[model samples]
Target: MASDVEDGVCFHCLQPIPHGVELSVAFQGDDKAVCCAGCQAVAETIIEHGLTAYYKHRDLDKPQQTPLLPEQLKELDVYDNPDVQSDFVRNTGDHSKQTTLTVNNITCGACAWLIERELAKTPGMIKSVVNVSNQRLHIEWDGSIIKLSDIIARLARIGYQALPFQQNQIEANINARRKGFIKRLGVAGLATMQVMMIAFALYFGVVSDLDPTTQQYLWVVSLVFATPVILYSGQPFYKSALKSIQAGSVNMDVPVSIALIGAYIASLYAVIIGRGEVYFESISMFTFFLLTGRFLELLAKEKALKFSTNRLTYMPNLAHREYDGGLEDIAAKQLKINDIIVIKPGETIPADGVLLSDKASVDESLLTGESRPVTKATGDGIVAGSVNQSATLRIKVTATAQQTVLAGIVAMQDAALADKPKVQKAIDHIAQYFVMTLLAIAAVTFLVWSWFDPDHALWVTLAVLVATCPCALSLAAPTSITGAVHRLNRMNVLVKGAQLLESVKHLDTVVFDKTGTLTYGQFKLIAREDYADIDTINAIVSGLEQRSEHPIAAALSQLSDQPISPDAIQNYPGQGILAEIAGTDYRLGRCEFIQIWHPNWQPKRQSNVILANRQAVLAEFQVDDEVREDSHDVICA
Candidate 1:
């Protein structure tokens, strides 16, 4: 059977197409054949530009082409509908739905804390975790107690804009935030350097010839430079602090904002009187350092890119929906259970369904660990993210978009952010209490100092506030987690939350899978012995393994400068790979898998990746992963 693209069937008209025309249309992020250039350009242009004039302004004889209508402007209550909720909300418990929402205007840790604090009062909110790095909210609530719309409305009431999570929203948010933060950071950084230079002349008398009249000039100049840094670059601190206070709580930024505003006022008073001290340099310097640290942390998080598979990111947004013995392209989210759909070879199976085709081959690598394609026939269950391999398939959908296994995996990922580890919770509580107590202490110290030395009371209080700002204490758990999470993410490990790693001490008994959990999933190379030629084996092995996604394959990928492509490449999941390299058949895998090619071959150890040709074992490579540090101690204890 010929594929539609190869059969020269025009995607636009479904007519016999000219072979040499080479015109195509992009449909649902994939290319399709078109019979003529005119058919290709107009439809694609309309789709891309949303031009409805061609249809709307057409004459009546044009058969009344359907006018493209704007998607209805939605009220938040629309999310309460199961049809709309099906996109980003998934059932997680008997009466609960877990939701992932992309949020905007979250600038600091305090914003996240304020969100969590406010939502804690909502009756149905089981959990809410706001990630400041990417501004995503992972929330779960009992459907019986409240609705998703109410959750979103509450977020809006707290000065946040939220919508159903979309794949690109987080990235878009980060990019927008990065641009704005860069501008603010540049202001603070340059102003800090200027203020510091002027401060040196005033503080240490750097210019011996500098006199009182000139000194007053330099102090005013320092104040001039520091003004914009405090007002503009320091906006985030003030906004987050005000939100926290308005919500009837204190956050780390409460101290920060207090110090920033208090110092700026004191500095202004000193410049006016020409009689006292100013901390314009401290204000500028502190803001610059804070912004710098946050910028680097964001870059690290950007490097710790998400594993897109967890969200089925590769799945097409549109699918071929079977309608009355014909197929129509429609949004995949619009698919319903029992809706039949066509799956051509090389296309991803869109939703969980049962195969209706007589026979088909599917690459179920995403659902199962097996890399080799699996054969299926009528009535066999199919998965959403699997790729159709050999023949075209018609599948009767068994589950809708939200009910698919891939969506379930995404829901589980959201649930990972549900709650805090007990110790982290304790630390956060202490930090909050510490803020309240320190404010009291600063007030008392000011009162006592005013009695002994009225001249310096304001400075003493300002010093107490700035020096004791509990930013580090308040940020300990989150900062520690992101730093560690960034490292683990580089190794393809996704940590659920601070609890997963930090709460291990509370586990009395621990159990872990051998390959990826008890030990690092990576396989370290020990040696490569008795190869036909070092370069040849390296090229052959690298070529095959580089094309594969198996864990062990990564260890040998760096052996060659470039991989040599093989012919007739075949992968046997639990056995080995069979291929032809340079007109010679080669096998690489377990000793047992290589035994057919070289019968007398034996593995030197309990495990080895042996490479063999027709006659003898050409190479035996050793690989191992040391048990994770303290694994034994934790399990025994």
Candidate 2:
């Protein structure tokens, strides 16, 4: 049935190659066709490294990646030049620079460890850290000795693709991680249910009444269902265990992985030989429960970090930058120092900059914890992440995206996450040693039980491993702290870290900031001097308040319905709005602006909004602070 033509199978995977396929590479002096580009690149790499023996022994079903082609890899060579690398590298003292790289093909914790170790062994490398959540590798090295290209090339040799870190790419990587976790959890959960069904049938003696062959057949079915759960669903634990041992330390995962794998293997042997009691149900149940707990923990961590991650929404994605003859909209991150950016009312400031306009009021309650809108004028610095509350303003950037005050706060929060509280560190240390001790006990129990009863030694040993795991013990503090944090967040209290819980226990005093922090900062219109037509007065006052950005102005502005836009408007810095409405001039401000029209008007002891014209005082709006009801109770308590 074979054709006479020279049709061939892939040399690497031994899959049939179609005619006209271009995926071929020279391997061990023989030209061989590969099934696809991914296989072709892998074959070339193996042959180039004199590892063609891998082709003869590798699992044919092993997955492969479509790696970058040789020509595409040549672009990375630009990193060899200092000038070209400066965009992604930051220089420190001693001719060293640090860079964060996005590494692809990191399927497990072991891959991260391998990349770190390989980088550590390089001559000029000082440090390397891989963040598994974001798949980002931070590296510091002596640029004088190791070029950027060299570091990237070495990681590529280890079968990972490295490039400069991009925010979008990192986000995609995180999403991929969550998707994978959810998929594995689903598979494990399904297997657990199926295994438990068969297990319960045997437990209830329903299958015990059946013949020996029938029970054996049920055990084999359970084994078939549990294999994928133990191997694929629980693969991360195995990889983590391997890395922990390679690092000369132990963690909770080591004991967990050992117990799961050991139990599964024992069950497998028993099922194959058909002479011993099998643990297929136990392995399935254990893997499913452990994975469920881990998935919940990941969700909890994401929820706890939501407060920090949500802050990024305060910065606008786009800004109107001043350009030749007009303004152009550009990404906020592209802003540079000395460039002028135009921020309109109600929009957030893009960066820390100096206000170039005459004046504006900015709401900085979120950034500085100030409940009031702070007024800024020409030459005054306006911080990023604050809203432009009143007037349009042109600001000249004084800091780049990464150097802004908001960025610094985010950086501090990240640093806090990296550090462990004393109690947490102590717990982790205990857990690490606990794993080592548990392993020793498991081995001893197996040997001692074997001496007394060889037939049941494996089951007793499995009991020792499962019953003694410290998963719940290690999770206690973090789970309690995370729950407490979520509760506090609902009550408008933001606790930045678990260390706060430790500090709260010793608290002797409490302090609070007034104005939005403890009391409502806005004003309530309580009275009016003259009983003019309420509708007419409301309309006129709203027009005047529309041009002002003061907090009081906002309160007064909200009291009107169908507010009329003034035909012309002008603002006095720190004063109020001057406007012409319906062919009549009106001034709305403090007593000073009112005095210009009515010299007899005097300052009221309480907060008052005075409206006037060239002829006389039109109205005086009396206002008062509407304090929060809970403020009194909170203060007393």
Candidate 3:
């Protein structure tokens, strides 16, 4: 009867209905429920079955703002259970007590202030920092009493989610960056085109040369069109320049900012003076080109940041924290110094710590850029961010999360912002004198041309200023750096930055690690000698060696090819293994273990192994290692 748009489109059904058509679907909030009478009945049944929140949260297609209050979190029974609390405390160590979460949900400085105020209300929270650009929060809190889950759940209630570092989320994060860049680029491009069109009309005497009054009218039109371009399209440059100035550093944006501001003021001056001959089109075009370059640079930087961030985030979200004769998985961030953590095979070590269990081969390639795995034994120190390749390890954390190698990588990335390429330095050098040189040339030209013709001086000065713009100089460095970076990326060698490329090109010496880098460090069995009644020796050596991750152990295991179990096995560091099988005892290792029989015998190389009984040498095994196929070429190249 109302004949309103809302009545025509059924609020619940979300479909246009004839004026007399009956609709049975019920509407809630701002969402439409599209259904027939029977379907509406089913929908109501679903909502009554505790699915209303699901529909409401889903209908909005936005993150639900369901804040978990501290009291509710406590009731979740997380704090009451000493075992759970101790597990979390042990895994995160005492360092979690001093750390705080800095959240990224603060959309602006005002939002940041508001979140900080809320966090400050909570006891034991020393600080809350928010970085809006990356959408990260740094929080410091006392772990002795408060818990990280409580903090995270509290943030979630306020419409912000605290995302722990994780590798699986990398693709989504990268996509978001790409989308943001595309949106900004689109807006800047559209504004650039509109401004250019207005500038062109004013430049070519389209409507400006009609009459004095008409020229004034045209000037107003140009100003109206250009305002959006300078404000919206040029905002990034202005912001970047201001940030650099505040930090007392010079970035590429500083010169671009100067140029844009100068062009805007000069163009406005021309309009006021009733002179439309000046090339304001050039200024608009320059802004557009400069912004295009900046967008490309930002895209490149985002890609690099994403790659390094993903690497740092590869550690598991939770770690098994050891407590009074048991273990429980807790958030990795809660891990503290001196906490024992059990790492299963194929799991990454989450923090820098000391290995408590014996023998683990860890892949440190991601952090050190090395391709080989390092064998770590009991009492050996393990760096954070390295991947455990083969055996399970239990480690006592020596440093907290923020004090580990992963944190160092994060710090290095932050410091790398100041790292500039060779091309940027060249541009900076040119920019230093560009403004002064242009002014001097314009002044000389004006004085020289005034004697010949009074009107010619202004034209000469404008010509010098316009033609001598630093477009070519700006293009020179970025073009080369971009090409080099692209080429290097194609080759699978990710140079950290353009500055690193210079270091690569000028490298005077190259170093190689002898063990895995130059040679296949894995051992291969050449041959084995047989002896009577020595099946026991074979069985004992193989069983004891299976427990060892050393290259020699691997070689022996392959040669024996027999299922053997040692009655008892003991490892002697820097020597070898002692084992007993059946009624016989055996030792497998250095020549010193068999030196009683062959006192004059010495190993030809480090790869040889000797077998002996109490009275005589029984057998000897020879092993050899060969260089990697690429070793020669890598050295020569």
Best-matching candidate per TM-score: 2
lDDT, model 1: 0.72
> What lDDT does model 3 reach?
0.57
Per-residue lDDT tens digits for candidate 1, residues 1-637, read 1122335555543344543556567665667776543345434555566543443343333221322111221232445667656766788779988877777766555667678887888999988887654567888899999987678778776767676775544554455567778999999999999999988777676547668788889989998999999999998788877876876777777877888899899889989999677889998998888778767766655554463334567677789997888999987878999899998757988899999988776877565434446778789999889887655689999876778887887677555643556655666668767888988998998999999999889888878887898767656566566566657756656566657887666867645556555665457776668658888888888898886645567788778997798987887654678898778888888888998876776777655788888877878888676568877875677
Output the lDDT of residue 341, model 2.
Answer: 93
Off by over 4 Å in 3: 1-188, 191-220, 239-275, 278-280, 309-311, 358-377, 389-392, 405-508, 513-631
My TM-score estimates for the predictions, one after another, are 0.69, 0.75, 0.48
Residue 544 CA error for candidate 1 (Å)?
A: 16
Candidate 3 contains a number of clashing pairs equal to: 19
Global lDDT scores for all candidate models = 0.72, 0.69, 0.57
What total of clashing residue pairs does each candidate reach? 0, 0, 19
Question: Against the true structure, candidate 2 has what lDDT?
Answer: 0.69
Candidate 1 at residue 88, lDDT?
Answer: 66
Ranking of predictions according to lDDT? 1, 2, 3
List where candidate 2 sits over 4 angstroms from the true fold.
1-174, 206-209, 246-248, 478-497, 521-530, 543-551, 564-567, 571-573, 622-625
* Better TM-score candidate (2, 3): 2
